[model samples]
Target: MIKHIVKDTFILQRLSSVATENDSDIVKDLIDTLEANKEICAGMAANMIGINKRIIAFQDNGKITVMLNPEIIRMSDAYKTKEGCLSLEGQRETTRYRSIKVKYQDTNMKVKIKTYKDFTAQVIQHEIDHCNGILI
Candidate 1:
């Protein structure tokens, strides 16, 4: 079982990418962490829990979705808003797309392409920023 989170800015500042090996364990950890934090947050990234991998789990409309190696393929219209992170204190101004097309892999390593708009897109962009070592 995983307890506590990495709160050091230096560690969270480092960038992350796709896991090259032993993804099953990483996926399990991600799922476990996300499930454990479901009531506290709407989304989380691997790095938020100190794992430097390109993975993010988010809850939308009572459903949890996990994405590995997610990338925004297309974006339309930018909006400035304030968002908070579980790994950091308080919220800040963030510029995010109103809508985005993302490509990512599922836990089974299946490729998926999907588009998100409004709040869902905001959540995804925030988590992707974590994968890229951005804190907002």
Candidate 2:
């Protein structure tokens, strides 16, 4: 679907829903779009591309990974960091965990749990905030 990014703050503030197996195509599209725009987009939420589902696609070390219905189950102490979004202009100081334990479904809808740290952790946190309708 490689849709355009949504910049409407009112729209971005609305929460997204959990994605299901039926949304595999949507997830793929998001991954493609994210990778295509990796220069400007570190990661993206489905809502950012006009799909109102709880999904995110990100690039990690040149590989793209998708997370459906992602939630941060555990988080370390918060630290202030600068972050920007595809839906917003300019970077701002945001508080985020240096490490996080997340539970999310893969493209196949299989639940997976993983811990992320450092920059990856920060990127995941930023995208998760988008899934939750929280702007940075």
Candidate 3:
């Protein structure tokens, strides 16, 4: 089911907890919500849907990818940019990386490490920040 976008900064600002296999339903809801808002949004954190879990779904290449407990292990080539959120009123300026290395769990709770660059990396960084209770 597509969930409502959370706009409450108080909620979005709270740190997200680690996700477990039981949170699989949240992964589905995240994907469904992201797809529903694909025209205007690229990604979303679990907090964005009123669930403060470490899960994120984003448009990568031509498909949507889900990550649970995503952490940026390494980041490089930082630059400033503005971003818009489906739960925010307008775009905000913030720093982003051109490349990033992340550690996260898949829906099945298997750990995976991956490198991302350019826009994709930026998107991941933004969502991870949401998990950390950082808002731009």
Candidate 4:
């Protein structure tokens, strides 16, 4: 089911806990919400839907990808950019990486490590920051 976007900074600022197999429902919700808002949004964190879990869904190529308990293990080629959130009023300046290697679990709860670059990497970094309770 698609959920309402959460705009409460207090709730968004809270650190998200690790996701388990039981939180599979949240993955579905996140993907659903991301698809619903795809016209204006490229990515979404679990916190964005009022559930503080380490889950994120984002546009990858022409499809939506979900990451559970995502952690950025390595990042390089940093640059400054401005970004706007669906949960925020306006754009904010922040640093983003051009490339990142992440460790995360898939929808089936299997661990996977992957490298991303350019816009995709930036989107992942933003969502991971949300999991860490850091807002731009």
**Pick by lDDT: which candidate is best?**
4
Q: Which ten residues in a row have the lowest lDDT in candidate 2?
A: 27-36
Evaluate model 3: give its lDDT: 0.93
Ranking 2 against 3 by lDDT, winner? 3
RMSD list, candidates in order: 1.4, 1.0, 0.6, 0.6
Residue 2 of model 2, lDDT score: 72
**On residues 1-136, what C-alpha lDDT tens digit does candidate 3 reach at each position?**
9999999999899999989999988899899999999999999999999998999999999899999999999999989999988888988999999999999998888999999999999999999999999999
TM-scores of all candidate predictions against the true structure: 0.93, 0.95, 0.98, 0.98
Q: Which regions of candidate 1 deviate over 4 angstroms?
A: none
lDDT of 4 by residue, 25-118 (tens): 8888898899999999999999999998999999999899999999999999999999998999999999999999999999998999999999
TM-score of 2: 0.95
Residue-level lDDT of model 2, residues 27-127, one tens digit each, is: 87898788778898778899898888999988888788899899999999799988888788998999999989999998878899999998888999999
lDDT of each: 0.86, 0.88, 0.93, 0.94
How big is the positional error of residue 50 in model 3, measured in Å on the Cα after superposition? 0.6
Total backbone collisions, model 1? 0
Candidate 3 Cα outliers beyond 4 Å, as residue runs: none
- What ranges in model 2 sit over 4 Å off? none
Could you tell me the C-alpha RMSD of candidate 2 in Å?
A: 1.0
